[model samples]
Target: MATRADRRETNPDLGVLAGQLLFAVQRELFGSLAELGFDDLHPRHGAVLAYLEVDGVRATDLSRMSGQHKQVIGTMIDELETLGYVERLPDPADRRAKLVCPTERGRAEMVAADKIMAAMQERHARRLGRDTYAAFKTAFMDVVENQRARDLSRRP
Candidate 1:
């Protein structure tokens, strides 16, 4: 291990590690997506597409789930809508509000994303040993959950 001073100079903190992982995953995912004709999508679009449901979801819920601001979600919705990936329809339960529903293109993209993610995970698991990869995921998720809980509690 490096000395304390060296570590401090180049500390790989939790945030840094998380961001690196995110960027790497996005690079791989988005590159493949573009090759498959989803050239319109970007890393930011993952905020909405990654967690979207087949039925539809509310922008507020997407914001909460993705830890993104409401305005950001709305803007992504608008962009996706214009790109013919999503449509905002009147929510049946609450006509006052709209639900963000995927178009056929969006659904197809979702399916492709699922396959790509699964293949990536499997590749990583094989490289790292399945058990070790599973343990790492569990540990990472624990960290994520704890941080999310703490952030939520601190919110006004």
Candidate 2:
């Protein structure tokens, strides 16, 4: 029988592989969060909170960074606000605009998530040797940076 790893090796589509890994990581993250008493949280919420700044950021900026529609990010922000994880405060630069800021609970969750991700990386390093894992991570980041550069170059 062909093992899953063998199958992945045979059909090596980086995008598909990346997506599978992302979903697996998300599952583990969600499970860990639930165990930590954040059962109400949704995986989609990560799109906004994962890259959010400590000070706060405009909703439009979050939408752009997350590559999500403004309305979609708006809905997530609303949900987060209702759950007391985040708050929309008037932007100091523009009173008409709102900045999304993490509440204490949200910051706590982010810390927990960081720990979980670190543990996950440690496990991967163990499985694939420390040196090899480091190289893999560096390569992945190079690819991501190149892609981001290309994307930015296309913008007006």
Q: RMSD in angstroms, all models? A: 2.2, 3.4
| lDDT by residue (tens digit), candidate 1, 74-98 | 9999999999999998989999998
Q: After superposition, how far is residue 78 of candidate 2 from its true place, in Å?
A: 0.9
Report the error of model 1 at residue 55, Å.
0.3
lDDT of 1 at 150: 100
**Maximum-lDDT candidate:** 1
Q: Write the per-residue lDDT of candidate 2 for residues 1-156, one digit (tens) a residue.
A: 987778778986777788988899999998999999889898899888887777899989998888788999999999999998899899999999898999999898889888999999999999999999999999998997888788879988
C-alpha lDDT values of all predictions = 0.94, 0.90
Pick the TM-score winner: 1
Instruction: Looking at model 2, report the run of 10 residues with the lowest lDDT sum.
Output: 7-16
